[model samples]
Target: MNKKGISMILGIIFTISLAGGVKGIKVKAETNNFTVDLSNQYRNVTHVASGSLYGLSDENKPSDDLLMPTKPNVFTQMAPNGGQLPNGEASPTGDALKVAEKAERSGAKINIRFPDMYKDFPYKWISLDDWNSKIDSIVDSTLASKAANIYAYELWNEPNWTWNAKTSGISFNEVWKKTYDRVKAKDSKTKILGPSISLYDEPWLKNFLTYCKENNCLPDIMCWHELGDAKGVIDVQYIEEHVKDYRNLEKSLGINNRQICIDEYGVTTEEAVPGSMIRYFSEFERAGVESACSAFWFRPGRLSNIITEDGNPNGGWWLYKWYGDMSGKMAMTTPVSQTSLNLDGMASVDSSKKTASVLFGGADGDNNILVKGFNSNKFFNNKVHVKVEEAPWYGVDTKLSQAKEVFEGNFNVVDGKINVPVTGMNKSFGYRMTITNKEGYINRYEAEEAVVNHANKFSNEGASNGQYIGQIDYKDSYVEFNVTAKDAGPYNMKIGYANGNSQVSSQKLYVNGDMQADVNYDSTAGWMSSGKSGTKDVQIKLKKGDNKIRFSNSQNGYAELDYIQLSKVAKTFKVRQEAENALINNATVNLSSYGSNDAFVGMINFGDSYVQYNMNVPEGGKYKLEVGYANGESSASTQNLSINGGENKVITFEKTGGWMASVPNMGYRKILNLSVDLKKGDNTIKFSKGNTGYVEQDYIEVTK
Candidate 1:
């Protein structure tokens, strides 16, 4: 749990991205008389759309609940993009990404909500198996897409709700450890903050990190969401007092050194619900509060989007090209002014008073953010030397840039500001701020792009796992691989996709087989250029051979392949099943009767894929089970599924193809088995998708 334990990659470089930051010069407030222009804090929008509302997908279609892996405890409503209709649910599409783009453009930082998927996404944790693969895929997609200004990845939303209250608290330790491992495996930069919880509830923070450290998952920053008192009035708003307590919670949890970011902190009028939540946020911020937006439409879905006006935000504030601003607390003109401040790098200034505010926006944790803009305002040439006498298992790198050129080994500052301002840059895409501090560490933005952008999928023309031998048409979208002799000799590997201009002067290839060519977003390259779906082709070279060949990230879409041949993979099959020791203890006033549907039923959660065990049923009735996937077979037609039953009232599930597909519209089905009246015994069920049915069975319950 030591935040400083990991090292950073030194002298790294990143292209400008994310576009603009903070907007609308809200007045600064000196909290507790702490005089610092933290205007950026209030520079946030309110009411981020839930996972159900984000507007993306082919059309504005809300997710399909009937296909839910399991019946949701609460009936979900189709959240709207203001007045806009629904979007897809589950993942982010270009449209959803656009929503985030639009929000950030209008000046909002959106939140990605957990929708009610009938399939029960997180229910996998209850299962005996691990959900590392699914978690990795989600994190991978988030990293690859650069979809939102991801501050914290909150655990399943409102997990403390009524339906989940009785359930044992999620083993946050396990979640953190696994999430850490997954992010580290691919990225070793940025900050992986999280476990965004419902409250600091007593020892919640302490318990969280204790579990994390004990289990090898320490968060860089602890995040929290406080659903403040619903009926509180504006001026008498005690939410501010409550928020301050969050900092106290951090200290109590021994996480004093770790920074705390409010993932969701706002006011509420009527019982603190979602809709009222938005109005609450607006009033609260206007009351001079520092907060971040929960965000709207940061994923691909048709339902939630903050901006109702064709994706443009409508409320408190909206994001525009990543560079959006929120109104700060300072009473306007009380000292509101912007001027060309000097030397100190002041962001804004009051020329009459000659006082300015400076903004030091760096990812580095040195906390060197100076309060006031240099005298009036300006960027000071600074030098930072990070000494790593002792190091961690992996190395960390840092990239420093200021417009004109990427600074590697030396500081590239001439005058105060960036050599070149990013004016006229594509506003749709945040070209990023004029300056940057790329701290290369375990948690990073999109480190994969740092390594060459690869295909989102691995396309092999061979039957085995490590087979790669190809000579086919290569579009900028596919990859090919082959096993060659280790014999020392030059091997010519012509790429299938060509720009055709043959501007072949300074082409370079590193020892790693990563071909270096001028990247063309318009031409065939990787995602930066070619827009392919999942399953495309890419080429890899081998010196002499015996090694497995496959592609990396498939988020850029598909990849095609000519062929692959290194070796054959051994295939093995394991029969999966879901079982129980007793039946749902009947409502016949017999509390002593212990059966599958009793204590054993709701306790079992299935994740990834599973097989079954002992089934002993007494009386069988109608049983309904649901399952879902993390990511795969996103289409209805390819939703391959299976269900097996055992004991008393055995009923086989009728496969309907798309029953176990992706989010919102998840794969679902109902089973009719009158025999399972376990007034005494047990029963079992098993399922899967992909080559395996990616089904998520929340919990098997029985009624009177």
Candidate 2:
């Protein structure tokens, strides 16, 4: 609320238990097993849902989606007049009591700021006696009200800024120690968080930590600001790196691991965009941050306001809603590779609900959601059900009456593999995928079996999920699957392969004695690291009878064929950016962003050179080619983009700035939309400079 544009709120809620009260709550047993095991050594203490509120009015009718336990007041106008209140209400803590009361009713955690009503920052600098009196009075008032949600008291915010500390010529370190001592001497139970530096400045943080250690008055939770996207896009990677630096500094300072609260994380881009906040949520969950709040300067119509003036919901509001509704312990999931290009997402599994919920988006096309990590030992009773609902920001002003389900179906998970196709995915909209259990879903093959060349043996040692064919290095080596389909329709086929080699390996897929598709196996971590291959999806039509599918490398043996998985799901011919025959000229590649192990072409600074991908088109028609990229400069860049060597179209690259200057401003916008016509088989698409700026290229997906 103050000039720092940050606040904390904590109060008794009628429904949800406050943070301090929830330590006694027991969690329900889970039915679905997760990939990220959280059994031992991991604690779900970081309340990623925690946020700051604007005022008591905002608290009167809190959104079920917003999960803020502890909130602080933003404005100093709420301070008491004359170091005292109007009778029986206690002294020097004016409307904060009222604000705290409303906050408690709404079930929030409160972090009350010591009142600062001076003309300027910190408001005023008074004598030691005056400061002590004010602190004692406010503490007494909150204690009288029995506000258990008042977990911590924050000292002056953004003290590192010169204006906030321009009082009585006293150093910020001295003021913090003096105030901390006063609060502790009165009520040692109330924790203190202070010198709330505005930014993650190394020199300032180090100095503050040193001062706290020397004074023997360290905060229970360390707090700082993450409003770094001043000139460019908010770089999620840069923020994560900065957090790690803080932890390292703490360890070097001989301080135990203290909780961190990013009290002021300002949203620079469109709050409604899926790429806007999902990446931050992922980083916070991974690092186990205690709390965070988006900085809101004005009350009613700020771009970052989750709730608008008329009490309607914004697109960003629904993201928090999905997050708030999610239950159970945070489950482990395989890192989504597309997130590197701004396809952002966070997944949680509630075994009790029989739901594996994922909040995903930031692409301009239909994205693929792959499920893995299930084993034979872990079993589910029924069919796997998946539903995707879109959360568009344009006119979604009111609370969601009911989420409009765009796609819903029941599918079988055989051999612990399944693909949940996400349609209507875009950067401007968000989608919540709920995968649960249903009764009638049936699988023809619980465990698929494949026949390999007698020369190559089936080895369990190098398999990722189950037994895979290995030791095949000669030409004409092949593996075949004898699969049966109950119905004549298109099915999604996933091939599990492992190529630990540094070079690209090729295989021709033959169905019923006819050439079907060319499978490319890229380098993985190792032979045993089956996850490195990822899941390659191909569309294959099967007759309502027995069929034979064979994968062979006629030229040279490539990778270890792991398994063949088939499901009665929709089909699409998808090609990744890292697919084979890529001609790189001026661009370089690396694993730069979130969940990306394969390299993406980056730093396209020159104009003459280009990188081209030889695409293997399944069926050529008018198809949408979605390009994934990020460019965070203030102005948009342009590229000479073409498909199948068609007429060159000017591709406008939008600015996707980042937090760090050294890092490229490649903000994640999962997909860039383009339309092109192609012939049935091989076609080449190239990216070259177009008399303008540079852009980072992730990959392109072509679909009808």
On lDDT, the candidate that comes out on top is 2
Give Cα distance to truth, residue 694, candidate 1, Å: 45
Predictions in order: lDDT? 0.28, 0.55
lDDT per residue as tens, model 1, 577-653: 22222222211111000111111122112233333433333244443333211122243212222323432222233
What TM-score does each of the candidates earn? 0.31, 0.54
Top model number, TM-score: 2
Point out where model 2 deviates above 4 Å: 1-42, 45-47, 55-96, 115-134, 162-168, 229-233, 268-274, 300-304, 333-341, 376-382, 395-400, 439-704
Q: lDDT value for candidate 1?
A: 0.28
Native-vs-model 2 lDDT?
A: 0.55
Lowest lDDT block of 10, candidate 2? 22-31
RMSD of 1: 27.5
Number of clashes in every candidate structure? 140, 28
